[model samples]
Target: MIFIIDSLNLREHEPLVKDMFRLRKRVFADRLGWDVRVSQGMERDRFDDLDPAHVISVDDEGRVVGCMRLLQTTGPHMLSDVFGAILDGEPPLRSATCWEATRFCVDTEVLTGGRASNSISYVTSEVMIGAFEFAMSAGVTDAVAVIDPVMDRVLKRSGNAPHGYLGTPKPMGKVTALAALMDCSEERVARIRAFSGIDHDVMQPHRVTA
Candidate 1:
């Protein structure tokens, strides 16, 4: 499973990005009835656009299975405007060098049994871990992850402790709610890569240090 990591804003990647939104709607808005984002039909905003964001995940055969996004606050991000309510007193932007992790969704099409752990949930976990590594290699010092209970656990276990975590983890699918931050670390990056489930034999050595 050779996952692709692209800038996401590129024209060639449009379809992949679109599928990502569709999946988000299915999981968050349509199925769970988060309706809050139903009007958009697709859950996307400024942070998903003009912001410095990256889309890293896998497209098995043709369908999108695993997906996650990275946002650098050095520019602009959803934390500043979109879902400000979740932050309470916490600053939306952590630092000039800090970034935010957002819009993470994994497709349900993957087969049984996850990559690393015995639990199937590790499939999604592997993707997020990969995203963390990608963020670090991209030059992120600190990262704020908008998360809930499930994800907060993963983020805290991201190897290196990030710099932001405030309030409780409520439920908000793609509306950009709840946040946790961590400083980027090489160790974390490698751990995430190994967790990517790329079958160590094929994972490009340069792309993953672990």
Candidate 2:
């Protein structure tokens, strides 16, 4: 299931958030060598301090398998503050209707399937679905993601190709970073669901407290 956790409820789901950070450390810093900050086995940065909404995918056993971070573009974001070079001198897209999606990663050691149940492909698609759905529900019309070439190909293969791109690709760390613009539309969500064979709603109900 997918869980949307933000600053308001981050303390309520500490374990899941911790696991998500550790998974990011393994993927971005340890494995991909993305020049990210890693300390005490957790990869984090200043953006995390801004309380961006984290879309997390948990398996049946309650393990955080996949995750992504979403932040409003009208404020501080990676593409605008950190990866402005990708904009090629063009001002970073800043709008209330648009959001920036970043820090996407999955646990490869745990999810080893191809496209089968609980596989990497399945989890990736699930995370994407959750992100887009959540953004669309929040009155967002578009989502800009700072993704690498591999992730770009994955997005295309998973039926979530970007509608357009801003500027040109630039080498970043061990991969080339590209700014991909995707619409948060029902059609795009449906295409992903069809490609991943997921028909039911992916959002998990938020816990209600007295």
Candidate 3:
């Protein structure tokens, strides 16, 4: 299942949050070899301090299997702060209805046994469903992500292709990154669900209590 976690209520879900960070470290640093900040085995950075919302996918045992970060476009975000080069000469997209999605990672070891193709596709679509659900609830119209060409193909092949793109692709780290935007609508979510055979709500009930 998936959990929609925001910074305001993160304290109650400390364990899950920690697992998300560790999972990120494994994917971004250990596996992808991206230049990211890692401390004490957790991959996090200043953007994490911005209190963005997160869509986290966990197994039945509550182990984090996938996760992504969402931040308002009007605020400090990866596209503006870290990936400005991907935007080319265009101004960074800024709109209340558009939110930036970043730090997308999945724990393949836990979710997929030996990089099984089916498992990879399912986990990818599952987390995307979580993203659209959260964006709709928050009144966001667009979900933008800075992703590599490989991820772009994965999204397209999974039936959740970006509705638009911000700028041309540029080399980032070991891969080429570009800004892709997906519409935040029920119709789009339904398409992905139909493709992945996930016909239920992806969001897990919030057990966090203030």
Candidate 4:
């Protein structure tokens, strides 16, 4: 199952949020070797305090298996505040309808031996669907993601490729990162669901306010 959580209400979902942060620490800080802040084995930053909406995937045991963060572009986001170098001299994007999707990761440790561990598994697509649905619910029309080439290719191979790109690809820590823009629409959501064989609604009743 998936849950959409508002940062303000994160304490209400403590266990899920803790698992998500630990998963991020593994993916970003330990595995990916990004220069991010970590405390008590959890990776987090200032944006987290800004109350970005989070879309999370949980297993039958109620543990976080995958997660993604969404921040309104009009406010302070990674692309604008931290990863300006990825923009390659282009001005930062700030718009009410465009939100930034960051901290996207999955629990690779647990998904190493199943169909869910594949390149385009239900876990990945389900979170993508959840992100789009959550954004649309909040009146966002587009999403920009700062991703490495691996994730970029994953998006393309899964048939959810970005509709536009914002910056040139450049080295960021251990990986080369770029900014890609994807539309927040039902069409994209349908494509992801069809590819992942997920026929039911992935969105939970919980939602975040912008």
- TM-score versus the correct structure, for each prediction: 0.71, 0.95, 0.92, 0.93
| Candidate 1, poorest ten consecutive residues by summed lDDT | 201-210
Candidate 4 pairs with clashing backbones:
none
Best by lDDT: 2
In order of TM-score, best first, we have: 2, 4, 3, 1
Better of 2 and 3 by lDDT: 2
Error of 4 at 73 (Å): 0.6
lDDT of 4: 0.83
Candidate 1 regions with alpha-carbon error over 4 angstroms: 1-9, 35-41, 109-113, 116-122, 154-164, 170-177, 193-210
Supply every candidate's count of residue pairs whose N, Cα or C atoms clash at under 3 angstroms.
Answer: 6, 0, 0, 0
Which predicted model would earn the best TM-score? 2
Candidate 3 collision pairs: none
> In order, what lDDT does every prediction score?
0.56, 0.88, 0.83, 0.83
Model 2 stretches astray by more than 4 angstroms: 207-210
- Where model 3 places Cα greater than 4 Å from the true spot, the runs are 113-118, 207-210
Better of 2 and 4 by lDDT: 2
Model 3 residue 181 lDDT score: 89
